[model samples]
Target: MKFRILLLFAVAFLLLTTTRLRVHAQSGKSAARPNIIFIFSDDHAYQAIGAYGNKFAKTPNIDRIAKEGALLNNNLVTNSICGPSRATLLTGKYSHTNGYKRNDRTRFDTNQTLFPETLRQSGYQTAWIGKMHLNSLPKGFDYWNILPGQGNYYNPDFISQPNDTTRYKGYVSDIITKFSTDWLDKRDNSKPFFLIVGHKATHREWLPDLQDLGAYDNVNFPLPSTFYDDYKGREAAKQQDMTIEKTMRLKQDLKVDADYDKDWTYNRFDPEQKKVFKAYYDKISKEPAEKKLTGKALTEWKYQRYLKDYLSTANSLDRNIGKLLDYLDKSGLAKNTVVIYASDQGFYMGEHGWFDKRFIYEESLKTPFVIRYPGVIKPGSKVDDLVLNIDWAPTVLNIAGVKIPSDIQGKSFFPLLNGTKATAKVPWRKEAYYHYYEFPEPHHVFPHFGIRTDRYKLAYFYNGADSWELYDLKTDPTEIANIYGSKGSEAITADLKVKLKQLMNQYQDKEALQILAGAKK
Candidate 1:
């Protein structure tokens, strides 16, 4: 009886050891799956980032992503507006295909297959922790904490799952970072994770943190070369209502006073928030009065204030980004994680004397995109291929080793990170298509669509005006001259039209087709 008891105990110990070894192997396999963290911000212009050659704006943390990996030089957005651009990133499809064309309060179709949904199904935990701006509860995320539309900078409210909202007491950027790091601490370690840290900083009506007040007081930004463009030869440029001089108001935008005008932005602030804001702006308001500025000088003053406040907000954004990066490094997650720093769309940083975006101009059209994927991508790489916001979804999915759906319009650029070709038979896209549908409200930019090639860009503003504008980007890099009907440009224009029509057909843009039909050849 004693010998039989000893044999039973030995068998039990051997089985327990074998089970432990098997579980350890499975956990190691899970770790092999790359984790993805997409850090998206609002209205973050490429030119403002330190890596993109901006001496005025200080963005060391954002630059770190580019330093560690690749920076996409030609990253363009299909629609250069907020909501539509986010929709494009989620669906890997353009505005027309995704059914979210304009930011005129359109609801996103949640039933559509998002890349997050695919990632979740493939044994990954997904979360979105900040400004989603999609006007609806996010779908396909296992965890979601989002801000309401154009979320406030001070004491923002976060919308969690099942339509629950809780106001968090802090600056929006810091709060977002806190929530993101908290999520990382609690995530299931057995599965790979995909998280989106969306930031509302640097958006319109730019508000800086209390500590960042007067951050750019000592600096003076030079006026853009096209500050007094006069809109000669370009009808669309003349018609736009986004000029900094006329559109950006001193009281409303510059925060001179809470009750200076009927602007609705100040109403969102609480009494305590108002007190703090008043103390800061009122002290700075003396400069404008002392200068006794008017006309051009006044315009320059507004421009300076605009840059100051904008960069101040950006300062907080970069600081929060550093916090997240530090957490990743300390936690040992940075090795297997792919970190992407991008914006919904680029903003106008006093380029062309404008404060808002919507044009297919270079300032608004090209978004800032930098990614750091260890082991897969080499450090300090720069990709100049024409990439669009639509490519974000497929690329992330591809990195996770998940099969991309057939309906996704974007071709995964995962191979590009490694200097390899995409598995697709067709060559990488040489031209990028752009379309902007917002008009007659907000900034009053007209609806337009265009195609940009390696050396030229062709835009057709066809909502109210039937006109065409073309630029040879190589010679006219600033796009000051509209050479559409200029001599010796007939052949180039003709070729571009053919390419435009092909893109429209490929994307199934029926509305653009109807407009193209009525356009002058």
Candidate 2:
């Protein structure tokens, strides 16, 4: 009887020891894998963020991320459109490779490998909340609640798994923030998570929340210096229909003489919401008709109205960001979480008389990127190296210590943030590739593919028009002067063309190569 009692005690002690060891191992693993929150907004330009030098822009939350971590100044995109840019971000590949080139009639090819799937397979909880512009439903996320196609700003409908959609009352930005925090609260405590907080603010036909309406009314935005670009040597610029003078509709864009009841966007608002919205816009709508403004005066008026509405809409987006940051801090997740802020792509805020973003020009090419990883990234560090949207997926994977797939075209810039002695010596890319395919439909901007080096840009407009444009970015930062065939510029132009062809080959862009060959002929 004494021997049996001693044996039982020994077994119980062994079991307890093993349990503690297992728990300790699990806790260590969780500590190694930090949570990632990617806040991606639509059409938010780099120039509009306060950290990027927009004095009047009220983006304190986004600015806080910059102050705390790194701001990537030269972050560009593979394609400068909505759906395609999102696809590139997910796959870490270009639009052509992902088979999602244009926003219309394009379904994301889910058969291809996605970074989220990699993360999930590696034991991370993955979820996406808010605007997912991809036509198809999400595939790899453990949980997803997304807006239905360019989601309405008011009383938006959200689609969850198994084809369930529920209408939620409140502004879209606020609703997204609520859903994001709610998910974080309910996520599995044992595993680290990756969440994409997508926002649909500041898109076309900008509509602000009731509180944010007329927020920027008093400040008259100055017109861009190139607002009246004559399209001197740029054929594509001449052909685009995104100009403020002709393309902007006073009634639709500026809310001048708007039919709120009949318009679909305004109809989404409840009676009280509509009343408040109408009260503010009604004051501005009367002026255009009363003054009989036309031509340049009318165009400038439209530009001011556009800026006000766009910035006002952005106010809600910024506020929601603050909400997320506060949640991280309050919940004790800030220390072990990586927070990143970026836009789908850059938008033109009256730059070169354009409003939409389809050009490979400077304004449209560069998007805003700010990241905060508490202990890893130094506060107020700025990365001026060339980084593309495609690199986003690989970078996130690297942050979580997951292996980036070899098929992904983008190289991770994780070394730029990790500050490890080994990774600090790793080299970064010197150039970026860009392609814009949606054309002659919504914006009349021709299809083009280009390469941007540190100090030069070379683009070839194809399909509707065949032309080559080259700009020495050092001398012509605005890209107003094209010196493709200039006498003294021949050597630099030839070198850029060679580099462009090499980039096309590197990316396996067969279509671009064929177009380049045709141009040569």
Candidate 3:
């Protein structure tokens, strides 16, 4: 009797949905299988979005998506680095499982089930149009035109498959968005489409769009309290390679033709380009290069550089996102299409006196996640349940009615959109597990793993420094205080530590366990 009633309810719901869809369809509105557009940005912090409560950066289009659909406050990356995060998202697996853990790491195995590949198999057109930084060339797609690793902001070279590699002399943001829009503009109308638009903006040693270099020149930005952090509290955090004062490059880091050592590591520049580059920095610096900027002044300099460059890069992407959204509505794909905006990993923006992203800190741990699936999702909704980047593929597949592969580690959060609480609310991993493997290069972030519960977070730094740092998110969200050995929280710490171990084992992260244990000893 119960089964019959449930079946009847399902039939009735489908009938009502079809009726509504038909009404819209006949009135010059098309109701077809939803198109999926994932707009991904690079090294953008979760705190930088205006909708995410960043009073500093302005991201209107991203906010528009949040307002139109839902804002997932608790989205996290499996691995906090760029390539690993992207791999996890693609394979719905952890770094160990996916086997791509860092920038120079191995490629994500193409044999792994990918959402795009699944979509293609299900009769959807799949195209990737922009920066895809996997160690291996992009796989599992019909069309791809991607920039080589850490693509240039100017005169970037793109490797379009069928082996057509070419250089385009323009801003990376403009080119990426243009090509993405072009793909959409030329997609087959017979089948639904899944497009991945990845941007290489807001990455290291910030470079602003030429038009945006002077946007915030006059504004004296405030410095984070930890701006001059001397690696005081946690020994593990202090030894990182991602300091704004240290890792952040000066005029020479960016290609400016001036004096000083003209060598920019990780960036290639012509020998003759030195004079113009140094002169650019000389003009931009508010104070003479030799003069030391101390206290708040130094902090403000970093903030200004960060804001101007990051925002400038973001500006083009935002306008492009607006372009895509406009295309959906105008092309009559809006209501049925699902649009998502996210980042591979979160970056640090003056918080904790850092610039790069790698640590499991809040700024770097959480990435921006926005979704817009018109008919099924409530406009302007928000969810606070913890969501992992790995789960994104599963959710995409679920929405498209594709089978979630057994190999995928993360489960779908589609229930959250169906007006139901996150299935993870109960018996779901009460704590999130994280790991960072890349050592020395880029950001000398120590390899670590830990768990983040709703109210507290405990991380175990392995290798050089073996200890745990616990933070009460409710009482101290800034993470200024580490009460790892504090009294009265031992039981909670112990419990969380056990949960962390269990999660590690469950995720085939026995390696992290061995490291954590060694570090603890």
Q: What TM-score would candidate 2 get against the native?
A: 0.93
Q: Rank the candidates by TM-score, best first.
A: 2, 1, 3
Model 3 Cα lDDT, one tens digit per residue, 402-460 = 78889899998877765645433533446788888887676767777889999999987
TM-score for candidate 1, residues paired by index = 0.92
Displacement of residue 126 (Cα, Å) in model 3 is 0.4
State each model's CA lDDT, in order: 0.88, 0.89, 0.78
- lDDT score at residue 464, model 3, on the 0-100 scale: 74
Mind giving the per-residue lDDT tens digits that candidate 2 earns over 1-521? 99999999999999998887665343222346789999999999999889999988999999999999999999998889999999998999998899999989778888899999999999999999999989899988999999989999999999999889999999999999999999999999899999999999879889999998889988989888899989998888999889888988888888877788898877788888888888888899888778899778888998888888999999999999999999999999999999999999999999899897978998889999999988678899888889999999999988787889999999888777656424346777777888889978898899999999899998999986788999988988988999888889888888888888899999999999988998942
> Which candidate comes out best when scored by TM-score?
2
Ranking by lDDT: 2, 1, 3
**lDDT at 354, model 1:** 92
Cα displacement (Å) at residue 93, model 1: 0.5
* Top candidate by lDDT: 2
Off by over 4 Å in 2: 1-31, 420-424
